[model samples]
Each structure stands twice: as C-alpha cells, then as structure tokens.
Target: MESIFHEKQEGSLCAQHCLNNLLQGEYFTPVDLSSIAHQLDEEERMRMAEGGMGSEEYRTFLQVISNALSVWGLELILFNSREYQSLMINPINEKAFICNYKEHWFTIRKLGQQWFNLNSLLTGPELISDTYLALFLAQLQQEGYSIFVIRGNLPECDAEQILGIMKVQQQQRPKLIGEDEAQSSGQGSVLEAGPGVVEGVVDEDEEELRKALALSRQGMEVEDEEADLRRAIQLSMQGKALLGKQP
Candidate 1:
C-alpha cells in the first residue's frame, strides 16, 4: 500500500524503486537499487548510464525481478494490452501494475476496489478512474504503444501447480494476435478505423504502419528472449552464491 519513489535517482532506478515499494514490509525480502542494477547486462548497464531504458531493456529488467521474486514464492505475470484490460475488469488481489505512458514508466496498485497511480515523480498517490484508465488504454492502442501488466504476490505453490494455473489462464484468455500476422492471415485490420473512415474500412497507409510496427515488436521479442536467457544465467549464479559455491 506504500509508494516508492526514485527521489534523486529518477530515470535509471524507476523499476527497482517500484519493486522495492511493492516488496517492502511484505513477506518477501525487499531488493535495493544497487542489487537490481547489478543484474543488468552490459548493454543495459550502458543504457542505464546514459539514462532511461528501451523496451527490451525494461522487459529484461522485469524478467530479472520476476526471477528474484520467484525464489521467494511470488509470481510475476506480464500481460499485453488486452490482457491488462481484462484484469482491470476482473480485478485480482495483491497485484500491481507497471504502466508505460509515452515511454515513461509508472506504477499502479489496486487496494480493495480503488486503483492508485503511484508515480515516483509525483508527491503522492493519485486516484485513477476506471473510465480514465480505459480511455488512456484506448489511446495507447490507437498509437500502437506497448503496454505491460505485472501481477505479483500470487499464492506460493509448487512448479506443477503454477504451470497448471498458467495454462488454464492462457486457455481462458483471448489470443492477441499481431497486426502483421492478422493481415497475413486475411483478418483485415487490428485497430478499429478512426472517425473519418467507414466503420469497416482499413487504410492502406495505416496497414503498412501496423505491419512495420509488428515487425519492430517481433524484433524486440527476440531481444527479450535473449534477455531471459541472460537473466536465467544470472539467477543461476545468484542461487550458487547463496549455496556458497563459486558462480
């Protein structure tokens, strides 16, 4: 319920600050900025030094945090825009969000029925309306911006139970197909045409943009997969360290 801010360490430590806030006073041990920063790969470290994180770097950072939290019986579920909207509609307990608005990241936590935006740059938590959230999301969708939802603090369970739960969730959720894939499969368009266009009309230029964006997103996903591999190695090293073995 408490918020964490970067204070003087704005750009580089936003994700770490957010994680620290989420885990502090909880059953799990809180992680510091230095510990989080230490896990970054060489490229990410360079990105941090220059200020701000790109999409892939941010995804990598989340994976690192997820791996760390898993060691302590917590879950971190990353959701796309559609999944995020579904989550908002059917709110879950003990979950938090790391939202990207125009490439700037911030946190949103749900306490009871109210959603609070715990932006580090802000002095205090700001109340967020469901309508506002929906509209904001719609805008992001229109702009083709990436949205990520991170749900944490799930009930501690064994790997099998976790996998089963995830499988069931995936089956129940709607499949979000990429624009390029949808187009290639003759699905027409991804986003609904704007006011000027006819209800079902798809613009040629818009379609091309969507295709380009989809390709770009695909490239980022590859980078994210590599990041996952790196984080897995990092987590393995951390585990060995805890066991008093050389990593």
Candidate 2:
C-alpha cells in the first residue's frame, strides 16, 4: 500500500490523473493532451477540405481525450463492442477499464491480482474485490456509464510487484472526497456515538449498494435470456419452413 501511487483530484484534471494512475507514472500533462487534440483537429480539417465529410464533435471532449491516450499505446475498446462480447462476458485477461458518465471519466484497473477504483472523485484508490468486479461494472452500465476496456501494456509499479506475492484485504471501503465533512454536518449525532456506530452506518450503506448491483445484474441476465429465446424462435421457424419445402 505504501508503494501505491495515488493522485487526489485537482481541478478538472481527472483525465490526467486517470491516465497517470493507469500507467502507474506521471507520464502525461495537460499540454500533452492539448497537443494531441490540436493534431487531431488539423487532421480532421485536412480530411474535410479533401471533399470528405468529417464529423465534428464539439459537445464533448471524450473523443479527443481517447485519441490522446493512444499516444501512450493505450487503446480504449468499447465494453459493448459486438465483436468483443465474448471477451467481456468473462474478462479474465482484462487489465484496466475506463468509464465515462456524461463528461466525467474514471478508471478501474488490476494490479498484482487486486483491482482498484481510481476515480478522482474518491478520497483515494479503492480496493475492489475480484468477486465484486462484474457486479460493479454491470451497475455502472445500468447507470449510463460507457465502459471501455483498456488494452495495452501498463508500466509496472512497486505496488504491483509487491502485491503479486502477497494479497491485501481492504477493511474499509474508500469514500468520496468531502463525504466525511458532509456526513458530519448532517449527522452530528451519529458521529458522537463513536467509531463503532459509524462503522454500523457504513455497513448499512454498503448493503444498499450491493443490493443495487444485484438488481442490475438480474436485469442484464433477463435481457440476455430474452434475446436467446427470440433467436431460438427464429431458428425454429426457419427449420419448419425448410421441412415444408422438402421434396
């Protein structure tokens, strides 16, 4: 844990933090991303001038930011890519995932067999259990987040090397930055009850979070079943037609 490199939220630099955290280094800056965006802009304009219809996305910067990631050998594959559905169904080899909800971007990555939530909004890196990974991702998808599988090699860090041989368990979950202050202001009585009482309250909250994840997973499963049933019906109909046409 001591070797883990974490950068708390700073201004609107979540993109920078997300990338640096995934790569396990201070490898990119605003200037670098800006340079990439400029290059993309020039290329887009060139294509437009060449009589090709080019799409310009000014509503959001995600497209430009994703291109910036490519400069570092990082490729963001859509979680819902039809071509990669099998891979996502059982993501054993996945190294990292970047998620976007509206304009906010965050990353979830695996290091030394442990998964961590590297969201800038959190107070620090969150240690996520392997058992909870699929539920967590399914919940995010239900909540309108566009998840992308990060494909490429990530630079190794001290934490990864150390944890490879020794696994660490998280006793407490990471909270959003300023969460304590908000809780203190609104629930002063709860704080006065001591640390044990606080843990109880956190437990109740965690239970609710788990329930939401379970519900999301159930919904996804139901959808998949329905799709399979529809496909079977179509195939049965086609088989019947062929039988009727047989001489």
lDDT of each: 0.41, 0.59
In angstroms, how far off is 120's CA in candidate 2?
Answer: 1.0
lDDT of 1 by residue, 149-180 (tens): 55445333232233333321111211112333
C-alpha lDDT of residue 54 in model 2: 23
Cα distance off (Å), candidate 1, residue 216: 30
RMSD of 2: 15.5
Model 2: clashing residue pairs? none
Among these predictions, the greatest TM-score belongs to: 2
Candidate 1 global CA lDDT score: 0.41
Q: lDDT (0-100) at residue 25 of candidate 2? A: 79
Deviating ranges (above 4 Å) for candidate 1: 1-11, 24-33, 36-59, 81-94, 101-104, 140-145, 152-247
Off by over 4 Å in 2: 39-60, 186-247
TM-score of each: 0.42, 0.65
Q: For model 1, what is the alpha-carbon lDDT of residue 209?
A: 38
Relative to the unseen true structure, what is the C-alpha lDDT of residue 157 in candidate 2, on a scale of 0 to 100?
85
